[model samples]
Target: MARGCDGSEAGARLRGIYRTKQSPIFLPDFLRSRIHVSVCALICVVGGWPSGTEERVIQPVSNEEIISLALDEIDGERRAEVAGRIAASPDASRTLAAVTIAVQTMRADDSISPPGEVVQRVLGLMRSGVRVRTSLMDVAGQVAEQVREFLCTLVRDTQSEPALAGFRGTTESRHLSFECEIAEIDVQVSRGEGEARRTIRGQVASLTDDTVGRIAWRSTLTGAAEREIAADESGVFVLECPVGVYELSARVGGSVVRIPPISVA
Candidate 1:
């Protein structure tokens, strides 16, 4: 029916089980008892893991079957690796089974990055041709509850007076209202050559010196060149700016701190 990426070869992308849509057949309990029990046993074996024993390593009978089996591993690290392998296959990616692996792996360890936007991108790519996984629906629902906040913050007016930029404001998250300031800065550029290739680093600090955040470096280089940066945690960032005297600053709490310009050349 379905399969995992490892051991078994990836099969066709499933549109999912179509019962009535394809004119399904109804069978009597007495006639289907043997088949039903076998299916139920398989479900139990795959869905119940770690805590549930009686596990025997064997070929994954179906896509959902092996995915559930891989997810059963007691160790999240192992599960992530196994699940990642399975998700890479079109056969496994088409089912909610894939989302389950990603979410469970992340929930086991928040330090894991696959549970966030990375999952979103994968689901987005899969949904292009397959049925949406039910397991992912709840995550989508909770995120949608506050869609307006992200939309408003992502789109802001920078031309108005400082107060009207829409980037400086307070946002209500959970039960607390937090002060937020957003800005778009030109990327930092670096120069130099060979082992002497110049580099720059930027950091934002709280006035109390409690929290120091690095900036995400990304900019178009004109004279010199800029480095592209990526970080899993973006709340605060340290950016590497190339060589040049430029304006740089970041907002912490309700205030913005501007760093005096520095030159690498």
Candidate 2:
């Protein structure tokens, strides 16, 4: 029978290697006794397991880092250190090369130029001081039939001048007018002092009937939900807001009409 022993340094080290008592089932007693000796010999041959308060020997470089290095975004000592690591790794070097080739190919491609007439038309629209934004409900099938009827009414709706330029000195008020098959809407915008901010005073009246409904304004710049404005018995309403572009919507009877974006500035 094998000799039974008390806890000692050699015995404790062997216990650490074969943690489970059932390890004796897989290995014979003779082989189990050599577990500590084999572990020490392997460690001494390989210079010990990688551990301690030393810098890591292997550091992974990400694809974003490789792209940044290729773009010349890094500089000085840090750049040099990362460059050395990238040079030592074959995968990082290949990624940098591929990104550099793609950038060079893009730079070598020819530029595209728009047609002269198209450019002139865009310039004219900007110069006219008229910023027209398309209505969303009109794009959907909701206002398709009404759009054709309103477009014909728009020809007759053209009034004296743009509301943006109508404001006089000190008060800085502007009047905008729009007509459709449903209603003829007129809005007066002006800047307010102190706590009042800016205000939009408007009136909506039916072009075909006596029916009147609600009007609301949504700030396009802030991307907020439309705020409902209550109108008087005479079909007049007032809205106060900060200086920004806005889109107005009026619901009269079963018809809902949305105006284009109006810039406050």
Indicate which candidate wins on lDDT: 2
- Estimated TM-score for each candidate: 0.20, 0.39
Query: Candidates' lDDT values, in order?
Result: 0.34, 0.60
Give the clash count for model 2: 0
* TM value for model 1: 0.20
Per residue, candidate 1 scores C-alpha lDDT tens digits across 1-265 of: 3232221221111111111122143344464556544544554555432243223222223444444554563346645644564555566555646557676787787563565754654444323212112222222355533321100011222222254356455421111011223332322234434343444432332434323232222221131222223332333333434443333333333333332222334
Model 1 ranges with Cα > 4 A deviation: 1-197, 209-241
TM-score of 2: 0.39
State residue 189's C-alpha deviation in candidate 2, in Å.
0.7
CA lDDT of 41 in candidate 2?
54
Go through the candidates in order and give the C-alpha RMSD of each one to the true structure.
24.6, 17.3
